[model samples]
Target: MKTVLLLVTLGGLLVLSLVGGLFVWWGMGGVDISLHGMIALTLGCLLSLLLGGGLMFLVFYSSRKGHDDEHHRGPEI
Candidate 1:
């Protein structure tokens, strides 16, 4: 029951956010982008995703390989 309630609440919040975003977008005139602008947006989004994923991958890799543990130790003389 708790899990179901939590999911429903979260889903409602997501829908509300989307509706609010669309309303703001509509108020902003909703202008169409040129092909070049669209391509730039797509590439920018892809590169951002790639960079974020690569950094997260490094985080996990370093953690598993114990590199993260080194930070917890006092500096050696």
Candidate 2:
């Protein structure tokens, strides 16, 4: 059941992305990306993914290590 739902959702998103990209390409009317531009875009996407994943990892790590827990060592005097 869960697997079926996941597949359906992913399928819908894939279709939407393809359709949107097709429209964008048609609208651009053959505007081409230079090699440098393509490299920059790829690097930007990779950096964004790495930064987001690293931040999420730190959040989970801190939660598991109790760094985000409330302190109960008595209120400061």
Candidate 3:
């Protein structure tokens, strides 16, 4: 039952993403993109992915190593 539900959910998401992508592509038919623009867009996406993945990895790694433990603070005057 769980497997069937998971499969159905995934299938629905796949269909939705395909339809959304098609609509977006059709809507951008009038836009003219240069080679440099395409290169910049690709590099931006790659760098953003790398930065986000690095931050997430650091968070998970610190958490697993107990670096996120609470610290005792002295009373303020």
Candidate 4:
């Protein structure tokens, strides 16, 4: 059941992104944007996703390793 739900959610997002991309391309018809600017934007977006995913992976990894478990630290001196 969980797997099915995840697949459905992912499929919806895939469809939404495809539609959004088409809309953006259609809206920006014939706009002369610099090649360098487009390359920079694409690289920046890719780097941001990499960093965000790495951070999330570290968080989940730590949690699985019990790093998130609470420990009682007795009265502060």
Candidate 5:
């Protein structure tokens, strides 16, 4: 179950990175705004990083909780 969950999470992260890169590429083709392409790309990259980190942290926290619960269960004769 843990293996399956990890694989799925990694797959999702790969897709997210690709989509974010595409957005940054798309944003490159427009007329210059007040802040220009740099700002747009910077913010997009930052958002992606934050999102990916948050997802990874959630998975780790859940796994830790599951293990802790199992550990607290006393041995049965």
Candidate 6:
């Protein structure tokens, strides 16, 4: 069940990304912007993933670093 859910979630994201790409392609056709559209779309998706992943990493890293710092503090006399 968990695997099925994961697959469905990933599939939904792929479909949405493709739909976004199509919108960009059609919306900017007047200026021969297909290449630009694709680049922009790819960058946008990459940025989104990077930002989201970075935030998650930052949270966990800060928490774990603080944890280790406290653990390493000298024992009270």
The numbered model that scores best in TM-score is 4
Ordered list by TM-score, greatest first = 4, 2, 3, 1, 6, 5
- Which ranges of candidate 5 are over 4 A from the true structure? 1-34, 67-77
**Model 5 CA lDDT for position 61:** 96
RMSD for each of the candidates: 3.7, 3.2, 4.2, 3.0, 7.7, 5.3
Quote the positional error of residue 5 for candidate 5 in Å: 29
lDDT for 41 in candidate 6 is 77
Better of 5 and 6 by TM-score: 6
Pick by TM-score: 4 or 5, better one: 4
lDDT of 5 by residue, 1-77 (tens): 99999999999999999999889968899756666677997899899999999999987997877965786789988
Assess the local accuracy of residue 30 in candidate 1 as a C-alpha lDDT between 0 and 100: 56
Q: On residues 1-77, what C-alpha lDDT tens digit does candidate 6 reach at each position?
A: 99999999999999999999789868886756488897997899899999999999987997877975786689889
* Deviating ranges (above 4 Å) for candidate 1: 1-23, 75-77
**C-alpha local distance difference test of each model:** 0.94, 0.91, 0.90, 0.90, 0.88, 0.88
TM-scores of all predicted structures: 0.61, 0.67, 0.65, 0.70, 0.42, 0.46
Q: After TM-score superposition, what is the CA distance of residue 34 in candidate 2 from its true location, in Å?
A: 0.5
lDDT by residue for model 4 over 1-77, one digit each (tens)?
A: 99999999999999999999989988997977699989998999999999999999999998888867644345669
Which prediction has the highest lDDT against the true structure? 1
Clashing pairs in 5: none
lDDT assessment of candidate 4:
0.90
Of candidates 6 and 2, the better by TM-score: 2
Writing each residue's lDDT as its tens digit, candidate 3 over 1-77 gives 99999999999999999999879978998988899998998899899999999999999998888777644345669
TM-score of 6: 0.46
Rate residue 68 of model 6 by lDDT: 54
Error of 2 at 12 (Å): 4.0
